[model samples]
Target chain A: MATTSIARPQAGVRPEGGGLLHRLFGRQPAGYLFLLPWLVGFLGLTLGPALASLYLSFTDYNLLESPNWVGAANYVRIATADPRFVAAMRVTLLYVVLSVPLKLVFALLVAMAFNRGLKGLPLYRAIFYLPSLLGSSVAIAVLWRQLFAGDGLVNMALWQLFGIEGPSWISNPRYSLYTLVILSVWQFGSPMIIFLAGLRQIPVDMYEAANLDGASKMRQFFKITLPLLTPVIFFNAVIQTIDAFKAFTPAFIISDGQGGPVNSTLFYTLYLYQEGFGFFRMGYASALAWILVVIIGAFTAFSFLSARYWVHYDE
Target chain B: MTSSAAAIPAIHQPAERRALWRSILIHALLIGASILMLYPLLWMLSGSVRPQDEIFGSSSLLPSSISFDGFVRGWSGLQVSFGKFFLNSLIIAVLATIGNVVGCSITAFAFARLDFRGRNFWFALMLGTLMLPYHVTLIPQYILFLQIGWVNTFLPLIVPKYLATDAFFIFLMVQFFRGIPRELDEAAMMDGCSPWRIYWKIMLPLSLPVLATAAIFSFIWTWDDFFGPLIYLNDINTYTIQLGLRSFVDSTGQSDWSGLFAMSTLSLIPVFLFFLFFQRLLIEGIATTGLKR
Candidate 1:
């Protein structure tokens, strides 16, 4: 939503010309009245807690006693000694790097396919979008664990068709993160819909011109479609990267909430959960949370900064 | 039948054939992809109904003999019945959805139509919250709720909604509200209607589509939420469907695969039904805001 100026009574003037209270409070008591709920929420739920967490990140509080300030001790320990923190960072980075691009590419390809005036477009879209709707649900996460088990459907097909055995993917450290990656890719529908919307906004005359110039379909896609679609791509990239970093349920469910099998699927959020709730190391978890915020902030900032070079905008 | 006419038809035949072939190929590709995408879900459905011995025995979708034994066992297999879990989920989802719609609409009206001191500052702050990861505040909020003796209650899950903590819905509504011509509010004001009357009588009624979008999404999100319940709701009696499902796995420990599958299938039914009924609104909502889920 754009933040455009709205009609307002002039400062120091009241429409009804009331007492001193009207001028002191400005001419829009009704505005603050309507904004009361959100103001309360922002202060109470978001801003207050956020600042509290930042303070707690520098202290040691296990919920049993008052927080004792450690002054960067927690951050030092994480950077130097904590193996699980390192593992979590490695796993989460791998997941973000592997998942976001693959998901976006798949979304773009499917969006392109659907943009060709395909028959049954709605049906195809609904089918594709179903997974994303159900993706974060524990039910789907449960189903995912089964699908990658040793005697699961994947291995069953492998043995029956190709005469090869497959690993119990979720239990294998080598393949566990890959299963989560595939799961992330499977829910590519949301980005696809956004991409489709972006695709529709591209003028058809551009395609007609390319067609008349003897451009091949592949050339037209790389030359016209990709450039025009960069804004949507950037949007999807940032959103999906942030989402992937925060991914929890699949790793939690599939790992039996342990982030096990050598901690391969120990996502940063999972590790934070383990520290915060599981172990009651509230201070450590607060530190972890702030680190995640910085990481995500850096990513978003990087995307926005890099966008100027590659993300084409008409305006 | 001149030679030129014969050549024209001949030239058109191969092109038409090629177009037909391309369409067939595209349809085949799409159909293949769709089936692959749907196969796991279909498998889960079939697995729930099939005989226990046949679940891991074959990868085929068809079950030679089907039974509802899984549903029968899974429904009451837990300490608390699945029905109770469903009711708990329904209550939380409904309450959360109502809170989000009502709270977000009024807040949006203020941001969209009203003018106040520090309006720009607050509005920018509100947008900034959209980018802040929930984890940053989650621990402190958990601690706050714990201090208030709301650790295991649905209040921890649903109360923030009433306070308009979900800024996405407010943003969505603000966008939608901006599209409704300010003339409607101006016309109502000319009748000496207060801003409250304008918001109540004019803005909201015109915002049904966006409201429905917010409602459907909030309901689905609340229903699908696992972390909230996992963190705050510890009692089995108070557990939502998501917690129930996860506990079903933990308690069953691979002994009741079919039961797990059965309840999993049951848990997805509400979300699936919502999608089937409101697919267009849901898709358009995502497209408009680029919101994931």
Candidate 2:
């Protein structure tokens, strides 16, 4: 369908019967005209800045002074000497490793449950999706801090229900990052919705066949549903992983924009913000940014490569 | 079901009873989970109305005695009123939505309908930009804006939308516009209508669903954005609600819990309202493309 729609224009181009130069520049000026805003933005905002940042990454530019070229010094320092860089990487990696799988698991479970021909499915789905809508807001981040405070609701519930004392989870470095992990998991609604859509696409006759063959629900799920859902699972996994890497607001707000509680919540983006805007280390921040780009690019490449081994396609 | 049940009453009775029990169990579990998910927001809402002394150490969603004191205090808690922050956020979000809808749809129209040289190449490039992270471009864009003296103004936040920098919307609109049949454009062209007129009169009307989806998302994202406004709009008078809420955290410092809750609840109202009014569209958008808020 996509290919046909994209190729339809080719026939239109041939029918115009213009010379190559005329076809390129004269025949359909309206196409370029309509695309003007996006073209300008792509060049100025995205491509230009990307190249400029790559150049800045090799320099020692501070905001007040003109850039002084330093030829990979920033990358070398990051590779060797920067302790906070290591810490930030550790925090971000742990976050990505922990949050993505947990969120996906929760999302898959809830989606499967919802997919079971339940009554009031729309109401249930909306209730589940509310968090994903509101979770990234500053209000939610603030509410999270209060929820995990020593005297806050979680501790209060712990004491009242179980007679156990709960520490301030947000302020305890030992547990601070875990709070953020839980927060990430709490917003599993978006992935759950995607999974629901994917599950809906699976043919029901397959399930009926399994049931007639004396297979239990568990066996059918494992043998049929899991195999068919791999593509959606892979999609959710990659998108969630990239998003987890770029997570900034909750950590920044929760840690008071310092990534504190002994740097436990020092998300990579938060650290980048600190370096760029806090210390005015524009060059160092650009280096950090490029490293992030490399890490994300590498991860995306790895995922696409590995997807061939696991991702199931009907074709 | 009744005819089969009558033929095998003994077997059917147990199965029916078991199914009922299972249904009950599932509903019970779902309702329990729903409560767990909504508890925190309800908590904040309740906290906002409670008196100051009663705000902490209470997990109940009921206020001891409802009071407007928190709202009054929070509205004027900082140097600039929360109303100003809200107005700032609204201006930015509304302008961004208009810019995105107008800018992206036209770009998508060209890509999906027009026959142009290098169309496929440019389309591929546009899709590639969808995956690129904003961090790499952050510093240099900031430098560009700073050099042009766009810093400390809303220009940095709003101008990019008019230039259609958000490739996600463009990609989304492209997918939608492609689904629009070419026969309609051909028919319109036979009547001597220009492409622009056809887009304005036919495509835009037919594509309201996608446009609304893009507009709603654009508004919500711009309203919820913190980093852009945080870096660009430093002045207190120019802060968005996210920045205002952050500064409220900084200035209050446990001095006013109820006030903080009040403002936080207020900050989420616009987004919550959007969700309520556009629930179906939002869900369909995410289901189709996995759009993030």
Which candidate achieves the best DockQ against the true structure? 1
lDDT of each: 0.91, 0.91
lDDT of 2 by residue, B1-293 (tens): 66675579787789899999999998999999999999989999999999999977688899879998999999999999999999999999999889989999999998888777788899999999988999999999999999999988889999899988898998888888889898887766655566787779989999999999999999989999998998999999999999999999999987798999999999999999988999999999999998854
Interface Cα RMSD for all candidates? Answer: 4.2, 4.7
lDDT of 1 by residue, B1-293 (tens): 67587688788999899989999998999999999999999999999998888888589999889999999999999988999999999999999999999999999999998766678889999999999999999999999999999987899888899999999999999999999998787755555567787888899999999999999999999999999999999989999999999999999877787899999999999999999999999999999888796
lDDT tens per residue, model 1, A290-312: 99999999988998999989999
Question: lDDT tens digits, residues A1-315, model 2?
Answer: 222223233323223535675456544556787889999999999999999999999999999999999999999999999999999999999999999999999999999988878999999999999999999889999999999988889999999899999999999999999999999999999999999999999999989888889999889989989999999999999999999999999999999999989999999999999999999999999999999999999999999999999889974
Q: How far out, in Å, is residue B38 in model 2?
A: 0.7
TM-score of chain A of 1: 0.94
